[model samples]
Target: MRRRKLLAGLAATAAAPLLGSGSVQADEALLGELLVTRLRDAMLGLGTAAAAPSSPEALATDFTRALADFDACRYASLAVRLPRLIRVGHALSTSGGDTEQHTLLAKTYLLATRMLVKMDEQQLGWMAADRAQQLAQSTGDVLAVAESARQLAVLARKAGWHDQALSIALSAADHPDLRGTGRAGAAVRGLLVQSASYTLARRGDRDGMRELTDEAAALAKELGATLLRDHGGGFSPLTVQLHRISAENHADDPRAALDAARAISLKALPSVERRSRALGDIAVTYDRLGRRSDCVRTLLAAERCAPQETHARPATKTLISSLLVSGPTSTELRGLAERSGVLV
Candidate 1:
């Protein structure tokens, strides 16, 4: 009886954060949270079991589910909850007899944490990335470590540390394990090269940037990888917008940048938040190209599509402000604002 009570107490404690009460909609949220909580607990239990007698396959399953949840709720604060789970997963794989499993798990954690950082949850993401990097080194997982270094490079660039970003990116590109690891997919290698190239370009190493980008593009073509596929041409959607922005920076023709932005906007329209962001970017690109009419039209379209949420209002306002800034506004712009019921 005591044991049973103790187990029940542990279960309730684990589940408390996910449980809520109120109306039907609240219950749905509670249910979703509960499901995520239960998955997290199961992952913990699997890790414990693996520690006793390592089971790489079970650990992989648990990590996959945890990853899915993390990806789904990345925009929220749920990304902060992933590092501990990743640590347990890394432990399970490293302790197990499967070298492949160890390498993959370590790399996945590193990549996922990097993605979380790009989502603007920098602190938690960096902590997780740093932890994954340490674990990868401990396990002699050089490829995983290189990948983590690449992530750190990108983060440094985002934080305005251009020189540091360039150095780290070069290091990632030159890592022996990264060059030698057959386990790492071609797409991953392409991204690493592409990132290195972009960083070089930002640092004004034009020849180096061209050489690297050319190499990356050729490799991507050889691997049958699209340079502008969904989710930034990688497996994750985290860098989709960033990739477009980078491509625009390097594009010789303004139309190329406009095309890239349009592609992203088309891909993002299914999600309200992403749609608003993509539209705003498109408007900015048009403004940069001196296409004031195009900019105004796009902004008007964005305002119409934007949801009435507090988070979306600011972006809407910015678009409106931009439309007003380009003097001698088009009748089409005024017509759009009036028709969309935004002119009050």
Candidate 2:
């Protein structure tokens, strides 16, 4: 009986160690996973908390962070971060299940969708954008819905689905709920005009593009929404884009085109993508003006701003080639091309 008791005690002692080791292993594994998750969340700029207040200042801060990431060519990071932040912001705004929260959520989702679209993740963008639209509709938030529709239109355009873009933008414009709200209606109309203009531009219809731009500008003025007058968005960068496009259509006046392009380039230095686009435009304008040295310099600046690989790469390459042809001997241009690695 003593031997039997001793054996049982030994078994218990062994089992205790085994069980403790197993438990420790399990805990260690869980901790590793948690560490990984937290790392990923940090890389994406997400916080552990929910949302914050809906003040413009708060929104602006969020916007600034997102924009900074975008300008730094951190598209994937921005894509992950903006959506999470926006979702949290929505949650905070609508914690009480208020109609205002619902509206704010829809808008935040729209911003998230835009970031996804910019990152070339169309499927996810469409899903989120559609969900935002549904939420806006449920809340009877016509302005929010209109903005959502406009974002969807942009996605469609980027995907080369011109018809879809037009339909969505026009639908937003015609939403009955927006009719009474001057600012909202005007904004929707501006989107429609911008959509049409882009479609026409893609089809190489210069006259149609001009007409739409004029119409969009007029409507924007009427509503006191001058932000989109030069382009679709209400920011200096978009304004630069508008000026550059205008210069493109006025080939005969190379000086005017160059002036506009230079202005855009100067204004876009802080933004990588915008700077690349502006530099490309400037190079093209300089080429048209027969300013060989200036064209080469502008092309080189553009090359510096471009991502190693981006949706804008092909266009940037074309601009480089045009500037090269207009500039110094093929040797210098070839050296620049090799350095950029954009042209073999």
Top of the candidates by lDDT: 2
Tens digit of per-residue lDDT, candidate 2, span 1-344: 99989877754543331221112122221222222233234224444332433664565466556555555544434433454456465555556656665666566566566545544557667876887888899988776777788788878877888778878887777767778876656666676667656666665666666677667666655655234221223433344345435434442455656655544435534456555556666666677767777777777665555543232244445656665555455665676665544444
Per-residue lDDT of model 1, residues 1-344, tens digit only: 99989888885665434312211122221333333343344334522211221355655655554454433333222322343345455565546646666565565556455444434445545665676677678778765676677777777776778788878877676666677765244556667777777777667666676677667656655655243232222423333333554445554344655766655535533344345556666776787788887777777666555422211233344445556665776676765444433442
The lDDT of model 1 is 0.53
Task: List candidate 2 segments past 4 Å from native.
Answer: 1-80, 86-97, 221-225, 228-232, 235-277, 280-296, 299-344
* Prediction-by-prediction clash tally: 0, 0
Please give the distance, in angstroms, between residue 321's alpha carbon in candidate 1 and its true position after superposition.
8.8
Location of the lowest summed lDDT over 10 successive residues in candidate 2: 20-29
Quote the positional error of residue 94 for candidate 1 in Å: 11
